[model samples]
Target: MMRTIMAIVAAGLAAVAVQAAGPGFDPRALKAVAGPPNEVMVLGTPHLSGWPKDFDAKALGPLIDRLAAWKPQSIAVESLSGLQCDALRRAPFRYAETVETYCWDATPARQATGLDVPAATAEVERRLAAWPERPTASDRRHMAALFLAAEDQGSALVQWLRLDGADRHAGDGLDTVLVARLETLRQRRNEEFLIAAPLAARLGLERLEPMDDHSADRPYRNAEEEKAAGAAIMKAWDNAATARRKAADAALQSGIKTGAGVLALYRAYNAPEQAQTIYDSDFGAALKEPSPERFGRGYAGYWEVRNLRMAANIRDVFAAAPGQRMLVIVGASHKFYLQAYLDMMHDVRLVDTDAVLR
Candidate 1:
C-alpha cells in the first residue's frame, strides 16, 4: 500500500512539473523568450500632482534628462486632443512662437519673505547640476528653454488669472478680461505643450495625440444646466476620489506593504468600476449636458474607442520612415491602459520602469 501511495505522489509531481511548463516551453531547455512581433515598450507616468509644487526643476530635470538619454524613437504624451488639437494646429498662424526667455518668479512662500530671484534660480540650478547623467546638449538646451518660458512673468500672471477658483477682479483692465486671460493661458499652455512635443517629433514618434478635448466654453453658456451637471459630476467625482483615497489609505494602513505608489497605481487601474458607478450616479447625468465631466468622460472614452491607435499611429509613421525609435508623452493615468492594450499586439517590448528609473 505504501509503495502504491509513493507511486501516486511521484506521478502527481511529474504532472505538476509538466503543467508548470506553459505554452512555448522548450522540451530541451524548458524556456521561452520572445513574444509576438507587435509588442512595444510602455511606461506609466505618475501625474506631477504638484507638477511645480512638491518637486521642482531639480527633480524633473534629471528624470527627463535620463529619459532623453535612453533615445526612445517615439515619445507619446498625455496632452491635447480633438478640438483642442484643431485649435493648437491653428495657433502658429495666429501667434508668434517668440524667442524664449526665463525670469525668476518666487512662490508666495518665498515672495512673502522677499527672496531674491537669483537665490531661487540658484536652488533650481543646484538641483539640476546634481543629475547623475549629464544631460545631452540638446536636452540641456530644451531645459533652458523651458526654464525661460516658465519664468516669463507676463505669462505667469496670465496663468494665475486662469486658475479655476481664483477670485474675480472688480474693475481689472482688458488684460484681466476672461477672454483675454483665456487666450494668454491657452498660448502659455501650448508653449508648455511644446516641451514634450518637438522632442517626440524629433525621435520620429508615430505622432503625438491628446487624451481629450477641452470644453472651456460650454460651462458658462447654459448656466442652469451647467451648474446642475457640474454639481452632480463634482459630487460623484468627489465621492469616487474619496473612495479611491480611502482604499489607498487602507492599503497603506495595512502592515503588509510593498511600494505605496505601486499600490496606488493598482487602485487607479481597478477604478473603472468606480468610474462606471460615477457615470451611473446623478453626477454622470448632470455632466451629460453642459458639465465638464461629460468632456472628461468623452475624453477618456476616445482613448478606449481608438484602442491601440498609438501603435497603429506608430506603425503608420514607421511605414513612412522605418527603423526609428518612438516616444509617447501621455499623462500618467493612461499608461496602465496603454500598456495593456499595447501588450495584446505582437512583437512589442515594454521598457521596464524599475530598470529605467533605478
Candidate 2:
C-alpha cells in the first residue's frame, strides 16, 4: 500500500511539472501548440450597400453592437488578400472604383490626414507597431482614414494587425473620430460597409482576414461557350431558390435591428442541412450537363475550388493564434460552405449563430 501511494504521488508530481514546463493545457487544443479552441461566429449578411437608396444603416446598428459584445480577437471578412493584393496593385484605379461601388469613398480622410495610399500604409504600419493600450482620438482617426487610403483598403488591415485586436470606438456621425466614409470602405460589398467593418473599426482591430478567394475561376473554351453554359445553368434555376433567398434577406433586413431575427437568419444560413438545399436548388442546374462539353461541371468545379481555397485561407488565420475568437462576415450564400469547411478544422469551434443571435 505504501509503494502504490508513492507511485501515485510521483505520477501526479510529474504531470504537474510537465504542464508547468510546457505551455498550460488548453481544452480547445486538438494538437500540440495549436492553442485553445478558437471561437468562431460567421455572420451571413446581405449586400446592403447594393440595396435601394432608402437602405437604413442605422437599423443595422444594434446587430453590430451585439456582435461587438462577443469581444472577438479576430474578424475575417469575405475579401481577397495575398495574391489578390498583387492583382489590385496592377490595377490601382480599381482600388478607388471598388470603394465607390462597394463602399462610400471618404474624401474627407484624404483632406483630413493628407496621406495617400503609400504614405498612409507606411504611417499606419509605423504607428501600429508602437500603439499604446489606449489610443488617442487622433490615433484612431488617422487609422480610420487609412482604411480609405490603402490600394484595396489594405491599410485598415495593416492597422488591425498592429493594434493586437483592441476594440476601437471612434464615436458616431461627424463627432465620430474615424471618417464614416473610410469605415464604410472596410465593409466589403455592403456587408462590411454597414456592419462588419464598423465593428472592426470600433474595436480598433488592426486588420481583417481577407478570406474570399477567386483565383480558381478561369474562362471556358470561349466566351460563347461560357455564355451558353451560363444560360443553361440559369434556365435550370427557375428562380425558385433565388427568389426565396432574396425574400428571406428582405425579411431579415426588416428586423435587423432586433438581433433575434438576424440571428435566426444566420442559424438557418449555416445549418448543415442547408448544403443539400443549395445543390438541389441554387446549383441544381449549375452542375448538370448544360452543354456536351461539361459546362455545368465547369461552373461547379470553379465554385468548389473557390470555396476550398477560401476555407484554407480562413483556416490559416488560426495558426497564429489558436485561442482567438473569430467573426466571419460573408455573403449569405457563403455561410454554409464556409461553416462546413471550418467545421473540419481541429482547432476551430464554430459558435452557433442561433445561440449568438439569441
Candidate 3:
C-alpha cells in the first residue's frame, strides 16, 4: 500500500512538471515580431431579422457610419461559404438539417450563368484577378451575376448595391429573374444585407467574406436524445444570468428606433462586460448542467468547435495580406468566443469595439 501511494505521488509530481512546462511554444510571445500585425474588430449584434417589423433599416446608418470610419479593408459576416454548403449538400445524412437551415439554392443563378458552385467560384476569382480599377456598369452587373452563381448572395448584393440605380438591371448574365431576386435581397431584413454588404460597398471592398462554420453541427442520434438534450439546455438557461441578459436586451432593443438608439444598442452589445454575461448565461451554464448524457457539455463543445473554425476562417482572410484591417460582424453570443480564439494568433491585434462605437 505504501509503495502504491509513493507511485501515485510520483505520478502527480510528473504531471505537475509537465503542466508547468506547457507545450514549449507560445504564439502570443511572437506578437508581430516579423512585420505589422493584422487588426481585427469584432462587432457583436442582435439578429436584425428578429426585430419588430416597424424597425427601420435606416436606423443602422450611425452604426454603419462608425464602422465605415474605421475603414476595414475586409468585412467578414457570420455566413457559411458556398463551398462548405455544397459539401454539406452532398452528405445529407450528417448535414441535411444544417443545409436545409443555412444553405440557399443557387439553381437560378446556375441556370443564368451556366456555372455550378465550383465553376462560378472559379469564375469570380478569374474576373477579379484582372478587374479594372474603373469598371463599367456592365462589369458590375456581370460580377454580381457571378457572385449569385457562386451562391454568395452577400457579395452579389455588394456588387449590385455598388452599381448606380439605373445600372441595376437585367444584362450581362443577370436575367430578369435574377434582377428581381437582387431587388428582393436589397429589401431583406438580414444583417448581412443591411450592414455587412452595404458597408463593404461603401468601403469600396469587392467582396464580403462569409466565415461562419456549421460543419461541426452534430445531428442527434434519435428523437429521444434530441428532446432530452433540448430540455437539459433550456433548463440550464433558466438561471439568473440568462434572465438578466434577456432584460438587458429588451431594454436595448426598445430604443432601437433611431440612429443614436441603434448606436447605443451596438455599444451595449460589444461592451467588455458582455463577454462574461454571454458566457455565464449560455455556455457556462450549459457546461455545468447535470445531465447523465452530458448534453450540456456536448453543446458547449460544439460551440467551441464552431467558434474555433470561425476564427480560423477569419484568420485566413489575412494570410495573403497580413497587415490589413478586418471587420467581423456576428451574433452577440459568438463575439466573446471569437475574440478569445482570435486573440491567440501571433499576428492578430484585436481592436476595442467601444473605441469605434464611441
For each candidate in turn, the TM-score is 0.39, 0.68, 0.97
lDDT of 1 by residue, 1-358 (tens): 9999999999999999998886663332322334323223444444434232322223233444445667765544443322233343344332112111111222322332233334434543564567435444333322322222223232223223323333333112112332343333333433133234433433433224333222222223467865665565565455554575457546533421224343344334334353444344333444443544465455345445544565455445435444445555444445555656555433344555544444
**Candidate 3 residue spans exceeding 4 A from truth:** 14-21, 33-35
**Model 1: residue 202 alpha-carbon error in angstroms:** 11
Which residue pairs in model 3 clash with each other?
Answer: none
lDDT of 2 by residue, 1-358 (tens): 9999999999999999888795455444453444477778887766565655654556566577778888887788776643354444455443534433333244455555676555655765687689888875546545655654543354353343334334444432123434343444444446644566567767767666668876654445567886887787777676666677667667756655544555555556666666676667766657754567666677777777878888788788887666889998887667777777777677777887765655
Q: Ten-residue segment with the worst summed lDDT in candidate 2? A: 166-175
Predictions in order: lDDT: 0.40, 0.63, 0.93
Residue 136 lDDT in model 1? 40
Task: Report the Cα lDDT for residue 264, model 3.
Answer: 92
The Cα error of candidate 3 at residue 125, in Å, is 0.5
Better of 2 and 3 by lDDT: 3
Instruction: Using TM-score, rank the candidates from best to worst.
Output: 3, 2, 1
lDDT, residue 53, candidate 3: 88
